[model samples]
Target: MSAPAGGRRAAAVDPTTTVSRVKAADPRGHWFLLAVGMVLLACALVLNGYVTNVAGETQAPAPATDVSTPELDDVRSGGPVLNLTAGAASSAGPAARTVALTFDDGPDPTWTPQILDVLRRYGAKATFFAVGSKVAQYPDLARRIVAEGHEIGNHTYAHADLTAVSGWRLRLELSLTQKALAGATGLHTTLVRPPYSSTPAAVTLPQWQSLRAVAAEGYLIALTDLDTKDWSQATAARMAKSALPAKGRGAIVMMHDSGGDRSRTVKALDLALRELGRRGYRAVTVTGALGMPSAHQQAGGVERFTGWALNLAQRASGSLTAALSWVLLAAGVLTLARLGLFAALAWMHARRTRRGRRRRGIARWEAPPPVTVIVPAFNEEAGIQATVMSLVQTTYTGELEVIVVDDGSTDATADLAAALGLPNVRVIRQPNGGKPAALNTGIAHARHELLVMVDGDTVFEPATIGHLVRQLADPAVGAVSGNTKVGNRRGMVGRWQHIEYVIGFNLDRRAFELLDCMATVPGAIGAFRRSALVALGGVSVDTLAEDTDLTMALCRSGWRVVYEEKALAWTEAPTSLGQLWKQRYRWCYGTLQAMWKHRRALIERGPFGRRCLGYLALFQVVLPLLAPVVDLMALYNTAVGDPLPVVAVWAGFVVVQALTGWYALRLDGERASALWVLPLQQFVYRQLMYLVVIQSVATAVLGVRLRWHTVRREGTFGGTLPPQAAPQGALAERHPDAAAQP
Candidate 1:
């Protein structure tokens, strides 16, 4: 097959090429996209508050209504009721027989419709103060109010108290309400009602100052002469009595049609309007009763667009907020579930280890069988000598043969191994092939029944081979995963990997062992029976994760794969973030391929297929895919909501993780000082891992096959051998015969 447009062919590309010089298979465009998305989300969050405040301020009950008798006479002389520019108030009408009824906080689904019905029955026209948000929500009701010959007035969007808000907030409240009304019914109003305080005399000095500011915005303040007090009154009769004008004078009676159950208000309106008509008073709209031109007018083009924009924003914010909430909830549940499962399974494994030790009485020592240790090398010249020397000095009682397979290295990997000149070590060179092919070639040339596979960069302990081979004593066991540690863990990134190895990898391995669902045996160090290897057709190169594929194949064929915790091997991990990303991307993508290859196993009956496949699907595939969303939700919460709760939750999780890491380190006999970097790791390293998983999944879904990512080898483990292994200088001293050849 031809190489992908932006990728190199695995077979043709030189394995010695440094990762930094190679163009990454997929560029980091997704990171850019995610950053842009976060920016948009932040903007939306800020706008959400802005719009909400505007809605609240406009929707609050305006404390005053126009009630000046002289203004009513001016309005009767063909002036606008509540003069828009002069900031003058108008009363019900010039004559005592005319009355205007105004309702506030309305366009309610239930009460507003019933109130409209009562008005229609009585042939009355009144002004309804409509909240902007309610109009946005129920546009049809606002239209119905206008269509029935009744006037609609602005009540602000959210009914917020304007007296307590800033000047900008007050303007936003009124303007947004106007836009909402225009959008809903294509009508605008000039009348303004400042929420809370009643008469101009009743308003405080600061409130009066605020009122003047609002007047500067072309709003004519409206105040009520009579308040029905239906919002506070429990009975309809008392509310009606309170709304009646004194001495049959012109009055603007205030009532409400929303914000609460308005049944009493509706009943009071019914009785009060009837009584007013009987008392020779005519009920009409504010403009009609006052003999002034109607303030209601169709919205202009700009106002319509503004209204549409606000409505769209409200809808978008609601949807995104809900989605973020659900994602956060799922992330929390999954995180807790994983932590609980790991802790419980780790405890079980520890108990099992104690019991097994007690039953066996000091492990019942036995000489292990002869083993062939295969070290696959491709452009791994930097660490090949150390790796071979480590295996050559192994203290296993049984015979050991070390075969170094050089898969066409451009460097001196083969020549270096040949120069090693250890008695049991041999170097075999072949044309370039991948790691799987190299391993298969080495397996084909093995001279023993028990086989150990170690990476070209790994340095094993003196008793690592013996510890690994002992696990095969169980006839059902086909492969054993050895404990792999990060040898170059002095840097922050390296230290984070070390913690991950112990807590994330090893702890989970223990749990998988207990569940009999152990997944991958690391390529750095693992052992397998020769017959089992042959039966599985050696290491298959169908997936990027040949180790995982082979292990799963063994499990499917009813062979047990176990973990050997004492078979310690120190391997070099990628030190840079870029290298690490490339390495993990390959691993994740390869694991996905292998999982897909074994998809049928999910339905198969047995612990290997059922439990193991289910575990892989949930933890490896599913959870990693969900992790990015979890992180994004964390960011969203920190951006828009109270960050203290988010911080507390995150800190709590980190603390639990630290505790788990401490326990895992104790189990592995490692130091606890590394736990301090765990929290910091969450910000950068963990996010990188999540992104790798996301990119890998995206690549797989797009059907783009990624080539092998070669990591730079620094040979950091050359002198870091454990005390039980040959001394650091022994490779040079004991191999003086071969050491002189170079």
Candidate 2:
């Protein structure tokens, strides 16, 4: 019944093959998305207080330098305020028995407001050196400082130590602070305070030079004469006592309003102001004490515009961080939930399958049904011979026919397969049509009502067909999916595929069968009833994943599709990354198409819609899309934020996967030692698969049509049974774990 090799070709055309040209996926789309994501993450880091250091300094204080000079002597011996603007050196202080109270690191949402309330109650005016990053975060607080007769001064953009930074850094710090103030309250301050500075006597030679640089920029350095030491969390009485000027001398007292818990500072300020009022000492702003003009001035339009832009950028970054946080949380919860559910369902399925096997022990099929095996191949010469040989060697005690349909291969696939010359094996040569059309041709020519479909690169065990067809004994089952294993697991790529097949595919199948939510009967090995095929009008060529499409169609038609773990087949896996990407890209894209085509099933009353479709939508499409973003966040955290949490999370995820992988291998009768590769899969192989999903989604959304992608096979197990396959004349039950497989 075999047709001659290279028979006359037919002109039948496949609509899916009508695209103008075969194009690989555009690589720029995903790369561009990755770039945008990285940019957003960088902005997030800046606004979240990582780059700006707004969370406050924890480093040790700068040591005092022993070096001295004429300029250092003048600054160290001067009053609390120094003015060296325009090369002029001068010093000033408040009148005797008067105090100029100044607060640093402020405009705090908590203590600043309380400190301001105390000032208002006692009729005292003070100066607050506001951090620029804080002003941008709480503009209203900065404005309130000015509205209540309080003065604002620059504390650098992020409280950076001016003496430790370069000259350009000094300018940037002052400029950024001015801009922040301008944007928040439309005013800039001339008064400046270098962070970590105290009494004028502590001004070292290096500190004096930094002060000179600030003076050249036309800023008056406001140094503290009396230090309250409030930043160290000292007691209120001790701090209040420190603010008292010696011998009724004029002084500038320093305190803090932010940068940790400020409760003591708030009470200390209240106590100090009360004592100052009792002593008949008036508290005034730095400018009022020095008898100089107001330090605040209106900002120009350009400064205001630049400040506004910074504000917008910070706001956007904050919003993005917040959104990603929630998304990460949701993804974590959903992932854990899915893992738990799958494990539980798989266990139940295994239990039920074991029970069934025990009840049917020693029983055999009363009358074995005839079977037809169809192998639709195109340019699969590398493994076609082994595929046909495996089918012809099947030990089924029923009528069997093997059909190898060559869909216009430009290779010697037809010749090699027909050369076998097995009596029951046939070769049908036709013009190139896609896999679905070739499958339909095989179905039309099949003589048996029971049919099995296998790929040209797959080799099956002698008992595979018998185990596969036995599931059809149940009248309600329309199809059965066999277990497909990676045949070449000697390389890293092969090892990764092996783990994925055992964990992601086979484990999922076990659960899907229990829930009646089977989404796919992989093309490698699947069995179907001929009547069911006719009712569904044969396999549809609308999607690239004809196997998935047909399986979903059957589920929607109220037919049960079960998984048969005992029916094992070994298929060649792509050895290289490029070929793997192409194969998965087509799979993911075609699955998307099938899901879209069967969308109406969502509202239809059946498990197919409520369970299977919902599962695919959430776990397959939505979760995979979000995985990249989550992984990027993990990377960002590891690099910038705390890496402990990231490491802990990664370790936990791997532990869960390792446990699951071990269980999957045990159920499939594989060595548990293979789980060693599971961890490595997370770094490179997992990201590659995720990228495939991303590219496929982009292609689908853009309405781009793709030509069939053919993979190059190496004939890893050419024309031979896998080592683990049943021995020469042994029965399937003789396998050690045959009864345990489910």
Candidate 3:
């Protein structure tokens, strides 16, 4: 039964030398991508394909065949077009009459396999230009595409129309896809298909040239001659009508096998291929379709290509140098931004600590103080019932009243309130002056000495109110804030936002807690002392964001705002991009308005005042809206194959940030999944923060005003979880009566 020596040896293969395999979105995948990107970043962005098309003289039109064909207007009596172009033909072959059967938007789990099976049966090879995100989702399929003797082309990170995104963005998009694909396969890509087959037109002359210059370094275009229209039509008949050719002109048919359902496309491909076979014509690869020169010519062309290897290498070296320089510049800028934010945060923290520390002291001496809950409700009828009902069900011991203020709701926002019929919950109606005005009105009428503000559409844990109130018991604290999270987790959008909240609000709050100035107690679940709130003239609706205003005012008044991580509330995140944008726009506008409204606080140096000096340097002065622009610049430098050293600098900083974020989550005893996800939070998610900051600055500079109420899809919240449909590991289930007896 014992294995032979050879078999034993095979079983005992060396583990140390094995290359680790990674799945898509794997931590290793992310790190691997970061590393390869950094290295390729040094190698230059020329590996991505960009086609040069000459439309005019004096301008280097996209070097789309600088040797313009006779048909092109830009080409003149340049006696020999090929000689006029003055570049060697691609080592790929003499592409005189070849058309590659390229598949765009594919490697789908369903149809890709079928296509692969067909290609396998035919023993044919073709290039597959895949989207980065899709490839990221299905790396194995991408690997298989390459393994089966198919060339992999860069389609884009997202299938964005690159032609429209001319200039730096276009180049950057190509670079991102190329880098990601190369990182995936460890082989640089030299082919690309812009989304929608978009090409740089005459309007973007420099962009075209830049794209061409980058492409010339390595990649080549497999331009299309025929349209498949698979994604558009999708029906088998329509797909056949659009795809099957009339046996005349050899074609490069465009097809999609991914991005939603492509079953019909798959069925159509079978019919089309069979019909083509039935005819005298053949269905062959692009290389075969274009009669390529023999093996010797291919070898000779490769040999000829080696002649310019040194030149390409030099160009790569130059590009890497440029990239390193850009990275350095970016790091410097980001450092300035980080430093400025730090100073601002520190100043803000100092003021909060001055007030909060005393409260901490008070908590040590006495039982927790009572809390005033400020519920700033705009037009939130969709989910207010569940939110209020949940509040009534909380098991808190503190004397807390939910103050619901109507902020010019055009819907049945006010009607929903009276329907709830709770003794402790008080309803206040104010003119639709916006959130701040409503909060100010509620603050004025609040009966409790302590004020706690919750969004009318947010639900709380049974103990969240008590936990938040206890934090404020500390006499040193002017206010206490709890965690706000997405309660509605029905879609990919909600889950993504959930992760964002965990990474941003959860981790950032902990850091802020450590610093002692927990900035704005979100309007969603903020508890403030009545006097401290009134002292700031209630929440000032003059500013778009009253929460930010209140925090700054508390800082100015030497009041400490403490972050109570244990206090948790669940709220809805906007399910759509448009809604999210509107919410952020209002937030940005409000932040700017509040900053200007309380500009005096920047100069003041009280426990609250002096802290603002740091605030100014760290937040408002150096970094405020610059992060995104800096990122855009970094991406641009990368796209142009420039030397940028800032990538490393930011890499280190983000690593530290991610580690800190993980630590904060650990301290809070949150889900461990956040640890793995925090790093990605920076790559894709932090960019959102950059947008928020920019919008804030732009709104301030432009003096833009935003209305509070945003349109919403009616009846979009709190559908009862169907039988056996409850979420896995959901929060403790409450009886129907737990909220309010329906």
Candidate 4:
């Protein structure tokens, strides 16, 4: 942690400061987390595609030309089973009065169990071709299929039509399904049935090629003589009739217990089995009816292990997707609710301010009080002259003095301010302490009860100090936040920050003032009662954000901090993406530190906890944390589902933001034309902001103390000051004794 003001060492980890060793970053920590997040996102997308049947074909078109080769003609003239093992083509059929019963696309949790019960009751043996994805999902059902004296076959993972996929996909489909069955049932099957394929006569040229490939891999292709067409939800009688054979010739009948509602399939199976039994036909497994060896072989160790891993991955992906879906819903609702609250409260605050102004004239001091403006400088020579000169040119009708504390600047910051030779401006030199320390040094030397704090890089308007200090006339108001504007908004980055300050910060402040829970009196320009500062122990050096920490302290102490929109100060915004990231990272991390320090206020009886802290937690912390997922979900929807709804939602949100930005700009007397950049902010700028938040939260959680780095100032306000007025009051013409004040 950076050394505190008085050479005091902070503890290794302190809740009050949230600072640990500065070099404690685990190099692989958040990066590893990011990698894991990406992998999980990939898994979610893949599972979404599988469940939604993306890029999958249930069936292929019949061969346009029934062109037949010698091999094809022989297969058509043969029976249901085709074998191309040992580089030889062969075919077979069941014995007389013997039938093979087979189910495809099964092990379904809902229908597979029902079908299994019927088969068991009828004493019928059958073969089940279970899809790999389903087998992983319903592993117990796969096991039940094998344990119930039934045979199992490979149906290919996800039930993709082999003829429609690549060679790698076809192999993957077969291997994954084998692994799945092996893991679930400790058995692998050589019986393979290509999805959407019926009798040999129905096999297309493309399917024959695919079957040859599977046959080369030692799989016996099992085509059906009779396709029950149960998947079409056919009537039970029609499907039962389709299951019957001609002239009691043995045959293979195909049905399904999954892929859709299968009540009719179940009914047809029962009806067919009873009728077959009465007709002196026996129902048996394919291997049984064909008098062949068992198709299921005990699974090898490697296949079982891989299958286990596949099942684990699928389960984890499914669970994560489910959890993310709920979180997305919650984040969406909270975001909309927050927008509604902001709009309503901002309108109410504006209306109340106007009504109060009409009822009683603008609140002002009968005799304006003397005020001291403190500008803390550290290597800020770039804008120090303009900062001090702007203060000297202020049109306040009271005793005014500008104090610039040079906090161990290696540059000529002190020299630049002293070069101004302003009678009322005092330049104080202090050892290199942090911003809070410098502010404290200036406070110790301040000579007036009313004090204004400004950053060294900001310049004030002629009436800024006058408008800012007037809020102190109400004894209950402890501080007033001035409107801070972007001085360098010609670039896209600057314009984005400009929009944020207007729509996000200022709008929130207006509502915060009404709720009595103002969070931060920004350091760019804010006025404070010196008595409140002294009472709260001046500026705290514990957290990085002294402004936020002190303002929150004041709010908890029952002192009101209000926003004064008329008090304007223009400060240079970061010019590039890298600079913006650094600046926002510091702000967000420091805010996290301050919030952590003031967490006890939540349980205290005050609006500080109920309103301020609650708002920050929900909108600032929780919402940003969920933002990436929301974006990912939007992209997923656009890729796999109808994208019109996503686009509509996005457009609606932008419209709402545009309206809010326009109102904010109008309230601050800024051009509505600047609102043109609001929509573009959503694409790049908004993601950067949320990433900064995520990084800050990660740093805080990891207990890594980020060293405070100075942002390189462009001095956009360097030459923009109006002419300094001659020393007005007798008290201002004479240089003040820096050490003479209490």
Give the top-scoring candidate (lDDT): 2
Models 1 onward score TM values of 0.81, 0.89, 0.49, 0.91
Per-residue error for 572 in candidate 3, Å, reads: 0.7
User: For residue 84, what is the lDDT in candidate 1?
Assistant: 39
Query: What TM-score does structure 4 among the candidates reach?
Result: 0.91
Give the winner by TM-score: 1 or 2. 2
The C-alpha RMSD of each candidate to the native structure, in angstroms, is: 7.7, 5.7, 25.2, 6.3
**After best superposition, candidate 2 residue 94: deviation in angstroms?**
2.3
Give the number of the best model, judged by TM-score.
Answer: 4
Sorted by lDDT (best first), the order is 2, 4, 1, 3
lDDT of 4 by residue, 1-742 (tens): 1111323232221112222335454234786797698668876667746633663435555565677888877888888899899776789988889889999987888999999999999999998988888888889998888888889988888788787788888898888888888778888999999888899888777888888988978899899989999988579989999998889899999999888899999999999999999999999999999999889999889889888988777777778878888987787777777667887888888888778777985667778789999998999988888788878776676899889989889999999899888899999987777788778878888999899999999887767887787677777888999988787888999999998998899988998888888999999999997767777777887677778998998887778889987777878899999999988888888899989999999899866787888888888888888788788878877877789999998998888778777887777767799988888888899999988888889888877788775799887765435465321222123223211111
lDDT of 1: 0.76
TM-score of candidate 2 relative to the true fold: 0.89
Q: By TM-score, highest first, what's the ranking? A: 4, 2, 1, 3
Q: Per-residue CA lDDT of candidate 1, range 430-538, in tens?
A: 8777888888888888989889999998887666787788777777778899989888888998999999999989889888888888889999999997777776667
Error of 1 at 343 (Å): 0.7
Candidate number with the higher TM-score (3 or 4)? 4
